[model samples]
Target chain A: MSEQGYHVAILGATGAVGTRIIEQLENSNINVASLKPLASKHSAGKTVTFNGQTVEIEEATPESFEGIDIVLASAGGAVSKELLPEAVKRGAVCVDNTSAFRMDENVPLVVPEVNADQLKNHHGIIANPNCSTIQMMVALEPIRRKYGLKQIITSTYQAASGSGQAAIDELIEQVKTYVKGEEMSADIMPVKSDKKHFPLAFNLLPQIDVFEEDGYSHEEWKMIHETKKIMKNDMNDTELKVTATCVRVPVVIGHGESVYFEMDNQDVTADDIKELLSHSPGVIVEDNPAEQLYPQPLTAEGKRETFVGRIRPDKENPGAFNMWIVSDNLLKGAAWNTVQIAEELVKRRLIK
Target chain B: MSEQGYHVAILGATGAVGTRIIEQLENSNINVASLKPLASKHSAGKTVTFNGQTVEIEEATPESFEGIDIVLASAGGAVSKELLPEAVKRGAVCVDNTSAFRMDENVPLVVPEVNADQLKNHHGIIANPNCSTIQMMVALEPIRRKYGLKQIITSTYQAASGSGQAAIDELIEQVKTYVKGEEMSADIMPVKSDKKHFPLAFNLLPQIDVFEEDGYSHEEWKMIHETKKIMKNDMNDTELKVTATCVRVPVVIGHGESVYFEMDNQDVTADDIKELLSHSPGVIVEDNPAEQLYPQPLTAEGKRETFVGRIRPDKENPGAFNMWIVSDNLLKGAAWNTVQIAEELVKRRLIK
Candidate 1:
């Protein structure tokens, strides 16, 4: 496999979801055989071009994962709780995208279209899930596999680059001091370590990440426990549910949810969940309603799919539904869902 | 009522919820014996100052309600369906803020803190309701009179001045053409006789009004038939339900809802609905999560009460809850809930 196609690294390579996880692993299919980048000693040597090489970044410690077989990280939950177990003890299989080892339990949070077979239960990190719970789990895990979901609630609209890139440069300096009528400076957003710091440009910030004692907000408890551990099945279902209310809207790079859900089979509709999210896999429907065409975050910003639509139904709540997702919260909510779980761990060989 | 105290008339007086209903009837108690502003002959003569005198606008018609005793009518639903029943055939008792007689059957719709006794069952127009259903009925009518609502499911976050003042001057000229990067214009917004015109400043516009045909949005079927007719009461509850999705953020004022409800008594909690919306009446809780507090939209913009907070309880739905409301969609959702229903039709004399 060394004809040159999988050495990776990337930790927080010049931030903002690490330069879109190096432009979603250069339009993915994984093969990069060497592109380290790391970051955070004031972005080490600062440089990052990737697939047309330029690389540089370098400061993440624990010896920047020796022979780097694949990492990716995102660098914040305490630098992925200290260098993702030192790059899983040097064997290097990371993926993270922060919230540290996502509810640990042997960490496999993933969202390769809602749990890509939980990447054979990764022990070498994996995590990823919250860019508002990976676009509401790639638009409700294909309507919970042809209808059976149970409950959802969401209400995000999230975007000021999910609080990074300096909260989208403080929401474009609070929309240019609210259009030069001055005084609109807020240090960061709803929660950059809380203690009050509002002004999200044309405002609306129902806190995202940092409250958690039951008033929910560690981004609404990571979209209610990473959506019940990526919609756990095998009837370990633990009765689905999920709740969120994340907010932070002054959009900048897509992230508009507004779900609603509820299914457990009530004879679904809304055009059968908009024809099952227009054929699932990283969803796209973009509903039509006489062509006003739904799914917008300014036309899903530098899109990478997941653009669902106002697939209505819940008028008075029958089988329920309500949709209107959108994506690109730094690409499919956090660098193409962590480079799509490292391109499904390099197409199932589980990343050697 | 004429000791210089009752001939109101502001029907879209130089627009934007009729100059905040002439600064909420100069901060209420209704005593304004003569303020007649009217409008639409392209804002007629255009003057507009009010209490400090000035006046001018006029041009409405039906001889501009001859001896007008009260009309308020926000000039739009075809000029409040042609001058609110000709200002109720000149005797005048209107209130409408336009959806032109909300679901009509005698028009009462009011939301004076959840239907001020349906304003003594109004017959000559009372309506007001939708500024996202009068701030989710002042933050869920004291949790539906202490635990018995049954079901909600909102998700608004409205405000481009709820599509009025030229959609808040087209959301501040599309946020100054999106921070000067440009190409940001859009006609009026999610709706203004919808034919698509997205670009809600920093963005997000999941249709606010106009779609209606079982895909909701006529501002979500006026928040599901005006919350079962302003929380109806009596066994006439007609199965509570409600539902919405509204959206149109890039706030220029307020409206933030996110609800989730469901009560009809499953033994409610979150401190019995935050000590009953902190003793109800125009609610103002502002929840405290260790001081990051809650109700946002830039601190509930130009407040007029209704600022509720992230109430909680629904970690996985047990009687269900989840709050966060906010207000000022043109003050208490449309100019102090249409001058608090014309000051409860002047303390219940039920108008002229």
Candidate 2:
């Protein structure tokens, strides 16, 4: 490794995941020649502390990437779609944490532990998978590689933070009102711009995103399509089936999922899958039934690693298995994945 | 219906569901000659207000039903099993909320709207299906009657209250800690005796009950077996297959379910299903997508009727449909269903 440093820029620096990305990069081995923080105009004047130093947030614009060697974009899909190409055109390798470029034919959607090699085919810009997808891939890829994955059906217990800060605030306020036996009002989480908002403190909303014509939500569609792309690249099989029911829960930070999968190999047992996941990088196997050891959103919050438990074989399907997975939606789901991609870029010498 | 009501004894009346049964029965046509609220020795002497009058809670004993004409039991399976027989033997007709006698060959498992006729065969005691099963039956019975159901796949987004009052308290405490950026402590919900408790405020627990030998949870198995028992009595020629994945969510009250079903008739449409449900007693259709109207757990709380929404044809399979059904677990799932059975008992003159 060379001592030569690279100029880095963070897009959407004031957002929940953006702030975490900055925190994760602190004390890392990667050298930074210059640090650029960009955010929406509303948040531009604010200052965010990085490594104990106050970093002024600047307005995100195409010109902001002029001298940056690696750009981490978490601004959102709209901003990523508008400025990702501009950053790439300026010679900066962009790692976007938005859905904007994830399905783009030319952009490589990379989850470093699962499909880091996808970065080799990147056309200047790389895309980050959904937070929920990233963790599931991390846990399942090892099993998929050892055995053979056929079908995946996932039901997500996602947090409010997945929708951003306003959702978190809304959940807190709603719970306080509910506790006092008062009417709780909701204006965010479970689709803020939708026609109506429902209290999330003690409820579950099935619609995570506005419904598409086919009845599956946009979020559900993303999981289905993204898992196909990521698994196809990793497993080298284009026919792997994945279906997801993405739900917005009242949880503030961590996302939990009940995943049921059927493998092509019938001999794999729940213990065998647990063994495989325990050895997988960045995945912690917490599936001890006797001690009731398992992953939970509360414990997973603020942690970078994905926690898995409740592994068992499906009774109806001989080759099928069921498990529970939990992770900090803001950390491992968004920020840390983006940061990990940047670290991989430097390690692979993809960016200078 | 007579103004001179018979003597009524409420067994396990101090529970989450018991309180609601008292509320629903207040000022009803059924005469309450002497309102008796009974619970365990721990809850005895506590007073619960009914119809503007405070009723003293009594310790449940075999003699508790000596002169009572009807008994509503919401106690756990063990309590129901221990006491229900005594109540019935003492000339009181018992509507048991626990699963103690649900699949018992002698006990009639009754959902008033779907199987009120079955009340005639109750051998002194009637069983109420699990809460998740109750709501689904309300929403699907009509469709099944018309189109002939073949298979059902449901993923429940159940609330913490389904686990009991302590689970609800845990969720509240966890949310407070999450907002203050402090550690959360859990000791109940998702199986109290299980090794550890995790925050449910913003998370989902896939294992609702202890895992059975077959990998499916006891809760999941209950839904499957209960559906078979209930639907089996309705149509002789139809073969009904049911599979459920029950997940405990941060929701405090209502249980929401995502249900997919396939019918024998390919001509079935979402509008047709909605039309049948809107006219069906105990069911309210709230599927106006344009108005952003849907059944939410928050809105369904305290409501007696089951709320049905998100009704649409499944794009993947012809003649298949998907729907979102929400209901107050304490009401339709437990207490109200039991009360409805009492009403049916009185109507059928099963109880004198």
lDDT string, candidate 2, A1-352, tens digits = 1255788899999888888889888745678766789998999889988767788999998899998888988988899989989988998999899999888889988888898998989888999999889989998889888898877767787888999887887888888887778988877757888877777777777778787766567888788788888887422443576667777877778888877776989998887888788889999999766555778787787788999887876554578777788999898899888888888888988985
Q: In terms of lDDT, which candidate is strongest?
A: 2
What is each predicted model's overall lDDT from 0 to 1?
0.81, 0.82
Q: How well docked is model 2, in DockQ terms?
A: 0.45
Tens-digit lDDT track of model 1 for B1-352? 5888898888778777788789878988878878888787876887978768787887888887888888888877897897788778878898887786788778888887766887887878887877877888887877777677878888888878877778888888778877778798688787776676877888888887778666666778778777787777322354787778888888888888888888878767788787878888888888888787778776777778888888887755678878888888887888888898899889989887
| Model 1 error, position B160 (Å) | 0.7
Q: What is the TM-score of chain A in candidate 1?
A: 0.36
DockQ (Cα-based) for each candidate: 0.34, 0.45
Model 1 has a DockQ score of 0.34
Q: Give the Å shift of residue A328 in candidate 2.
A: 1.5
Model 2: CAPRI class: acceptable
- Clash-forming residue pairs, model 2: A202-B251, A251-B202, B5-B31
Lowest-lDDT window of 10 residues in candidate 1 chain A?
A: A232-241
TM-score of chain B of 2: 0.96
**lDDT score for residue B303 of model 2:** 85
Candidate 2: where is the Cα deviation over 4 Å? A1-3, A27-29, A145-147, A233-238, B1-3, B27-29, B148-150, B177-182, B193-195, B233-241, B262-269, B312-314, B317-321
